[model samples]
Target chain A: MVDGIVITGAGIVSAIGVGKDETLRSLLARRSGLPGGKVGLSDLQMKTILGIPGEETVARSSLLGILAVKEALQEAGISYTGTAVLVSGTTVGGMDITEEHYLEMLGGEHPELFRFHTCGSSTDRIAAYFGGFGSLTTTSTACSSAANSIIFGANLIRSGRFDVVVAGGSECLTRYHTAGFDSLMILDKEPCRPFDASRAGLNLGEGAGFIVLESSAHASSRGARVLGRLDGWGNACDAFHQTASSPDGEGAFLAMTKALEMAGLRPEDIDYINAHGTGTVNNDESESKAMTRLFGGCVPPVSSTKSFTGHTTSASGGIEAVICLLAMEYGFIPANLGWKEPSEGCIKPESEGRSKVFLQHVLCNSFAFGGNDSSLLISNARDYE
Target chain B: MNRKVYIRAAAQISVQEPLCEDWMLDPKQLSGPFLHCIDPDYRQFFSPMQARRMGLMFKRAMVTSRKVLEASGVECPDAIITGTALGCIENTERFLDPLCRGGEETLSPTAFMQSTHNTVGSMVAIALGCHGYNCTYSQDGVSFESTLLDAVLQLECEGAGNVLAGAHDEITDNVARLMEATEPGGYPFSEGSVAMLLSAGESLPDALCEVSDVRILSRREAVEEAVAGYSAEYVMRNDVTFSLFGRCGSASGLAVYAAAEMIAAGRYSSVLVVNESGSNAGLVFLKKV
Candidate 1:
């Protein structure tokens, strides 16, 4: 692991909690932070709303992202002098403000608000706080964006370009996207139930997650404690439809297979699978088929933490990657909440949170519209043992 | 890092022309408040149903990418990467214009699905049945540079033989007016798509140019200091592109397209394409093969 793309530090803000300790506490308690799941719709939003006290004007996405990035850099002991490149993923930049004020702007009231609508604006805003990064970019492949950012950051290091990279994504909820999913008839009235036969759809949520990725040499030289290694990543286009996953999950199978191949690990090496299960009929079925295909019908412990945080959409990939690290760190498998029953062939997720099972390698899946599907494999620090 | 990456082929649909390098000889002199990319006849590429369902941006991405792959003699690229500032603004408008007027129940699934930034990239992959590395970057003006950098990494580090990279954007009448009212540059908002097939190791006989390197920098001062080192024979700045094809996020990508055309025609031995958004800059180095 010391010669791999090791993650030195990770931070996240989700509906469940603001940081690692609180998130792990909530997960161990099997508490669902989603709005529709045993809570009011708008009452249980983000875990902590950032007023940041003395911060200037910035989008909520950037605000959340800044908080996450600060915690991550602090943990990694990264400062402005480290010359770390930042690769952030975000789909809705300032849409939360734009959608709310578009009509008024048409009448020439605060037209400057339109400037913040670009997805890159949020990345730039986040970078501005670090006094400027060595380099920065934004990825926006829908829901799988954050996963792709991590993949791209790993590539940058593997290519011998940068020593340290800050990779993750942030997203804020907006009425426009919520209604968009609702228009597709995919928003569940109740909490979502992934891999369950009676599942309806996903509930929308918002948050940000970030991880400090450093070349193993860079991390060791800086004396930063390596949490885990981002062993493998694969991104493939389903190419089946704009929004719907193929019935056979062709893209998902290919992605998982590629990740396994890249990691030089067999399918059986994976201790757990963090599924993309959006609680929709299409996703759970397709993901199950992919898992069955790749694992040869003997799938590992499977669950979707989206069951807790709802579908953070673009941010889910990064958030869940952090969740995977937490699971490996805490030696537990979080329960796939909201499941009542399963179909005949679908993999049944763990019903209750389990403790004392140290995960060696875990796979995380994130699928998005336009057939963008990505998978990442993270291995614990047992590599040098 | 020692691998030689070549621009095997390039195609673009813009104000000057569509899928042709004829603009190198007789460039179009066009001025616009909102310059829409000219679309060629789609009867040859897509079916009636597809043409009806897809918006202008999708068709542009498909046509340009298809044209690039064909010109490069690549049946299917190992990866398809694209960049766009606004995903599908037309479809987004289609979904939102009515929603603003009628609160709920008037949602268009088609519009909503195609409104994402990756839809164009996804459609291109579907057209080619390419299941390889797929990505989309939306980092404002440097979106396309981000894509080209990824393509470079895929070829050099990931052992990919060929990569199809492109940048696309479409300006709507509404967004054009908004830019005119807000943005200080009277450069006129515009739209276009530029796609190139990049290959590693050996160069093809008819390759357009060699891509030595590409970079995207956050600070303006760093770019200014770095430009002195390359000493390219010719440089195409943001102002030049702004005047040529109006303004769009992918205009920097268009500069890459234009540089390739110039190098292929022997106009310049080396060209450095530079574009900046505020202090951020994207640089693409191209040279005659």
Candidate 2:
């Protein structure tokens, strides 16, 4: 098997916190960031909302992404030199800005505001901040975007292409997204409860999460402190529906199964699962079924962190991946906040709550609209011997 | 061990015309500053209800994917992978327009649901009932090349037999205006779709070509290193006669175009094609053997 890609450093900016340490602290404290909505979009306006704090200065999405990337770079202890590939995933890039400014443009004034309409401009601006010029790309696959970005970055490293890559995803709350979810009738009126029988819908949140990925050789050359190694990843499509997952969670199951198979591990080897858990009725049910089918009665401790941070769309996977890596490092399982009781469909594990077990392997899932499903397996590099 | 994948059937729908036997050989010149696909009659493939909800890009993707499936004689590919630079821009524009106009009220879900970049791939899957490995990559010009790389990987690493891989981009009125306004030096606004049926173990009577290698890069040195790493014949190959480059999007398509030109000109029996997007490049080496 190929030597796994090393995640030397990571950064995060979420409603709960601005950096990795703060995010971890919030998780341990069970501090949910799903309070009064911001960006002029109130909970009354948006059926379900998870607004980011301190939204006055930076563009919510760009701010979160920039801060996260900066922290990641600092954690990696590598100065930005030479060409750096920037692969970002986001479902709503600058939509928050465009949605607001577009009105000004249509009002017969301030036509200059129209420039933000191009989703790529967000990446360009972010790249400009870092003085990066080698290559920059963006992926917009709804919810699974960041996971795909991570997968793409891993492939590039495995293929011996780039020396380093900043791969992650960022998204900010927007009136457009709020309206879209409201229209779909999937926006919860209160904090989202994943896999809860009375779960109404998902509460939309915004944040950015980034990981500095480098080849094993590059990481060792720099003496970087490797948090975890991205051992295996798999992406599969259900081809079932546009907005809803298959009833049997075929895509989710395949994605998880493929990820485990790629790592040459059985389902029992997984210690914890970071579920996509948008808190939507369909998603929770489908993901539960998929877990049941894959792990059977001996399912590992699975939790949906969306209750704490809300569903961040494309950024969900990236942010949650960071949480998983952190949990592995700390040897703790983050609680599934707002999970009062498991839904009827849920397959509970033997462990009642977060275990103090030494974490070896972790699985993260991100399933998006259009039946896009992705799973990533991360493990401590030293475990492979 | 990595296994070589072959592109058995290729289809394209662009500003020129739909994928016809003659269209690939003959050329069509577009007159307008902005380019739009000479859209095939989508009604022929989809019903009014389904067709009504689909934007121009979705229609083009469905039409092209169908044409490719027919050409390959494979009803459902084992995997479907797609790439789009700016996916479903029309729907996105539509959804954004009213929200921006009416203060987030009266926004339509149809356009919003269809606005995501993977809509085309999802629609293809829904149409074919192919619940296989489906993915959509959106990294600007390299989108298609990335999709091709993943399809090849599915064959090499995932043991996928038949895969449908392609790239598409569509031009919307707002997007076209934005392109002209922001990056005028860039290629004119264009819309098109291209799909290829890929497989391992050649079975066709005269297989077009077998993909030998693929790569993605961010820097010029990296690109050069990748090219050199392959120790591939940079200039003349014994069998490469021509190469085809999709040069509209950055020089990303140049590598592939050059290889195809060499093969097509009878200078070589095989060819290689490369496509790149904003910061990523993809190389597909096709050998006659």
Candidate 3:
């Protein structure tokens, strides 16, 4: 088998918490970040709490990315490696800043604000803060953006392209995105209930999540501690609908099956699954069908951390990857908060968090609009020779 | 054990004349502040209903992708990857303009639905009915190059036979005015869609060129060095310096197309193409065998 792409560092910020510990604590305590009122955008006023604090005038996306990168580099105890590539993912990018100054920008009052309108600006700012990266790029495939970034980073390493890659995604809440979602009628009136019979839709949230991936050879050479292993990743497009998933979950099933095939693992080998349960009527149903089809009658225990942090969109993949790391480290499976009854084909999510089980391999799924579906396999590094 | 990737076919729809076989030989330079793409007949490509719902960028992407696939004789590709700096900006602005003016009450859900970056790629997939590996990238200047890198890896490392990788960016009136004001002397505000069918097979009927390698730079200092290294390695003896440096940053795929054109015309055996936006940069090495 091919050597695993070892994860050496991780960082995250979300509505649930700012760092790994706080996020994990919130997950274990079954706390929801939904604060009963309108957050950023108007008209969808059901008390969805926007997690970012009002600390700086800079774009919230850049701030989140910088914060996450800082923690990841600090944890890894490395800085400014020459051959490093930073493949960041973001959906809204600097839309937060642009939306705040849209009127001014439109009136030609502030041309400076115009530069921050592009998605690459946030990624560039993040790279600048870290001195610089030799290679940097951004992926924006809706919700699966960050997961695809991780896959890109891993491929860079596995293809003998680059040894060190900082991969993840960041997104900040914006009135533009919120209103768009509102226009689509996908925001929940009550706090989101993933896999629940009464589930309405996802509660939009903002945050950033990232992990530092290094080759095992490079990590050991630098004496850096290995956090986990990125065993496999796969991405597929549904080609079914622009916004809705196919009834059969063809894209989702292909993504999972490809990831497993790449990892050289069987369906029974997966210990747990972090499902891409967006708490939407379409997503929950489609993903549930996909999970059932992939694992057959013996589906692994599953949960959606979105129940705690809300759907972070592009950053959800990165944040959930960090959550998976915390789960493995703490020897626990996170609870799928707000889930009461089982939806169609989905096995009942673990609403009660479980701990002290010997966990090994875990699968993380992220499906996005436009049929962009991706799945990642993360395994405990200690299990590898 | 390095696998070679070849560009089986390349197609582009840009500000220049649409689908002219000899466009580059006598290219039309953009003299105005804005350069809108010369669109092909939409009626021939999309249904009336599809055209009614489609935005400018989405239509351009579909036409470009269809032309490229037809040119390559590829009915279905293994993967479809795309990148766009400002995806469906016209639709986004349409939705945002009304929402910002009349609040959420006047919001158009159709415009909002097509605003995401992945919409163009998905629309193409819907037309092709390709349920294969699909992704979209939207990082300013390097967006297209990022998608190209992913497609290259898919073909070289994974067992992908053919991958359709493309880029599309449209400049709305507001965005074009903003860019014109910000960088008065830079390349004209422009819009375009470029697609290349990349294959790992040993040969093709009319391979434009072999993609030797591609590198993207985020650091200002590293850009020169990386470009120099690749140029020295691949295009040392080549004479032509095909460049669009200060041109439209968002339409970085133009440089890739230019390089492929130079190689395909037998003007140069190898060409190094460079594109930049702010501090980010993308470099491609193309060689004809």
Candidate 4:
């Protein structure tokens, strides 16, 4: 009924790599981008931290995002000439810089640090960098940021507002995020083991991912290679807690259920699920309960890619979506690293380097801090053929 | 598949004192470069310990959401959706202050944890324990309208009976100073939160208005597209009386303001309000039953 919004191209820049191919290769090999110590921190308190490493070429999030979008546009074979860009999703957005400048200003009278207040201004910079100026938008919905961006982009296409749209999210490592997670007592010093009985908390990661989506007609006319079809998406709020998923994952359940319903499919029609396994005790358990309620005993092969890339926060869904497409394209399933010994009443994710049956339909879940939950359904483009 | 959704109850906290009954429709001019909400005593609504951790933006959002819920007489809503151009700016500023000033040592955790843009909506959920569908949208000017659109989608596609949808934007010294330095020609700095209780059916007698449709468009084509897509003649025939325009952010709210003005002048029977600030734009049509 939607005439199908096709994902013609996708790109990703994570702690692992700066392009889709590099990221996938790293994920397939079970490589970790998490360093033993933090980068760019000079003080002793900053030691013993792990994150993605980069320099002043761009803000960490923006750099990763730009790398991803570059690859995505190339893969789509579209030149960035006056295209519409919509960058939706959440992040501290220049808070990394803002925090640094606030200190510098307090210590002395450094006037150069005032540029970070233009947090959302980075979207414009990205768009301009890509030679795009049609319409630019940014959405900040916590973890579900990029997923919501994708949904809004698709809606714009369906509404006949744009010919081509670039949508996704990005987040970068920051001391502020680390301190926040630490405050909640949810920062795991060890590599996060999602859904593990002994699971403790999430290990923060940073990256960006994006997809070039176009109307099916537009894609076909340009002879662009369609990676997959964005069948449907749904978003819901679990009006439950500030930082915790509901006991039953009501919001997650509704988002997934509604997405499938909109796609005109059922649970049996799904082949795999990319879970929002943040390795946190609360998230894994609640998401598992929600999956159980929705799929009953017939839950499909499920895994959380967060183990490989760390929790990318806003970019989690976008990166996961790219992984789903790659799985469908290559006929393989990436492993969920650090997952072992499933928790009580939870399904165990496929171990590292375990290949699954040929995937046809994949569901990706992205849940954020505000109880904002979003689910996206991606299926092989050949399915409709 | 287009369906009608009505705004049964509404609450707003703004510089004009829109929340209190005594301040109805009495517009106030903002004197300073920055205009903050005449905030109600949030202490009465939230516990100090809980409030101790929340930023001013989240506190305002919680208070406004509670006011809307109480006015609507709904113990729990089916969903909670919020939109904010700058989410938890105060918290972000607070979290960064110590790290920058104290050389990244002895930093506080509370500010960092609550600094994310969705904190307001998340805190609202924690306060209510509703366990329903809750999401936050942070798309610049159209943040609130995007939230409203999602609420409508819930009603039409997901069978949501009642939903709480709202938008809140707060002004912080950091944000105000930055805006002043960067974009000197932008609208005066303002902070406010508005919430509405939306129901599927005509369950309330005093339902303020019904939302007919909502739209988001590019600034370049907004006027032409709005005029073409939404005909003044059609609106006139449908008994639309006025429109509320959000002229602050590139006049993205102009469409609604024009519609509200028309309705207020008795030129039409219904009205529309539109707002666009930050990075997004939205239009909402209201029909008087």
Across all candidates, what is each one's fraction of true contacts kept? 0.73, 0.50, 0.76, 0.47
Better of 2 and 4 by DockQ: 2
| The 10-residue segment with the lowest total lDDT in model 4 chain B | B237-246
Selected candidate, larger TM-score, 1 vs 3: 1
Which consecutive 10 residues in model 1 chain B have the weakest lDDT in total?
Answer: B177-186
> Each prediction's DockQ?
0.67, 0.40, 0.69, 0.35
DockQ value for model 2: 0.40
Tens digits of lDDT, candidate 1, A1-385: 1248999888888888778787788899988887542212121132234434443446778877877888788888887722788888988887776777777776778777777888888899889877889789999999999999999999999988889999999887877788899889999988888888898889887888889999999888879888889999889989888889998899999889889999999999999999999988888999899999888868999999998988888888888999999999878998999888976557788867579998999999999998899999999876423
Model 3 stretches with alpha carbons more than 4 Å out: A35-57, B231-246
Q: Which portions of model 2 miss their true places by more than 4 Å? A: A36-60, A81-84, A103-116, A133-136, A348-355, A381-385, B24-26, B47-53, B103-105, B185-188, B200-205, B210-289
Candidate 4: which stretches are off by over 4 Å?
A35-58, A80-85, A104-115, A158-164, A340-342, A383-385, B1-9, B20-26, B41-56, B66-79, B103-106, B126-133, B148-163, B185-188, B197-289
TM per candidate comes to: 0.96, 0.86, 0.94, 0.82
Better of 1 and 3 by lDDT: 1
| Interface RMSD per candidate (angstroms) | 2.0, 2.9, 1.6, 3.5
lDDT of 4 at A7: 95
By lDDT, the better pick of 2 and 3 is 3
Tens-digit lDDT string for candidate 1 (B131-239):
8999999998899999999999999877889999999998888777666666855677898888989999765658889998899888777886777778999988988
Q: If the candidates were sorted by their DockQ against the true structure, best first, what order would they fall in? A: 3, 1, 2, 4
lDDT against the true structure, each candidate: 0.85, 0.72, 0.80, 0.70
lDDT of 4 at A241: 66
Expressed as tens digits, the lDDT of each residue in B1-289 for candidate 2 is: 3455777766667655466535446555434447666777776788899987767776777777777688778899988987776677778878888776674656778888998888888888888888787777766666666677777767765678889887777776666655555444434556667777888874444445667776555454566556555554443321121112122332232234334434534556654444433444555666654
Q: What is the Cα-based lDDT of residue A1 in candidate 1?
A: 15
lDDT of 3 by residue, A275-341 (tens): 9998888898888888889889888999998888888888989999999999888889998888888
